[model samples]
Target: MKLYQLKAKQAFPISKKEAWDFLSDPKNLKVITPDHMGFNILSGADRPMFQGQIIQYVVKPFPGYSTKWVTEITHVKEGEYFVDEQRFGPYTLWHHKHFIKEIEGGVEMEDIIDYKIPFGILGQIAQPIIVKKQLQQIFNYRETKLNELFGKLEGHKNYLELKSI
Candidate 1:
């Protein structure tokens, strides 16, 4: 099985508490996500994020493909980090970790996602042409959205990378 990993990091000119408050609230996901993805929270987003929390959503990853994704918040460490795992989703395996740290004059947010695609060999064939590009676009949009919401930290180079593991 081929497992893929995506790592993204961005620095923001905002306080750690401020960043935590925005990111910890599940509803804000729609704000950071690209509108073209047709992302919507179906349920389990009425309250603050916590361990064991289940969040469901409807997402159109591609045209004519709308799917219901259910993810469980498996871990949460207040203002530091949190983990979400896919319970029912498109991928065969989806584990995402989000972290935030206080940096000089701001806060830095990091995301690491490890996932395995379905359909085995066919999925591997489509990885570069479809999956990887889609993920890149999604993260790129998120970075832009976050920069607009909270100004970027000068001299901090943000990056996003995807690779096989």
Candidate 2:
């Protein structure tokens, strides 16, 4: 089996506590996600982000089709990191780890995703082309969204003040 992994990192000019609060809440997903992909939470998990917490979502990456993805939180460390595994989703297996740290300037967040596409021969054939391409698209969107959100908060004093708490 071919193992595929994607790693992404970004630093925000925000405190670790603020970043933690925003990312810990599952409902903030759509606000930070790219609009073109049409990602929305289908069902907010019953429990907060913790080991074995399941989060269901409906995502439309392609036209005319909505994929239902159910991911479970497998590991979590408060104000630091969390891991979400896909129990039933499009991919054969998906394991994603989100890491956060308080750096000198601000908070740094890292996303490490290990996933395998369905079907043996098909996965090998499509990895270099299709799967990799889609991963890039999704991550690029995420980066842009983060910049915009943080940029707005930084430029507006009142907004930043309100979120200061």
| TM-scores of all predicted structures | 0.99, 0.85
For candidate 1, write residues 6-57 as lDDT tens digits: 9999999999999999999999999998888999999999999999999999
| Candidate 2, 1-165: lDDT as tens digits | 777778777778889888888887788778776677688887855446777788999888677878999988889899999998998878998988888898766777888788888889887788767777777777776777877776423332211100000
Q: After superposition, how far is residue 24 of candidate 1 from its true place, in Å?
A: 0.9
Index of the highest-lDDT prediction: 1
Clashing pairs in 2: none
List residue ranges in candidate 2 displaced over 4 A.
Answer: 45-47, 152-165
Best by TM-score: 1
Which run of 10 residues does model 1 get worst, by summed lDDT? Answer: 29-38
lDDT of 1: 0.97
Candidate 1 segments exceeding 4 Å error: none
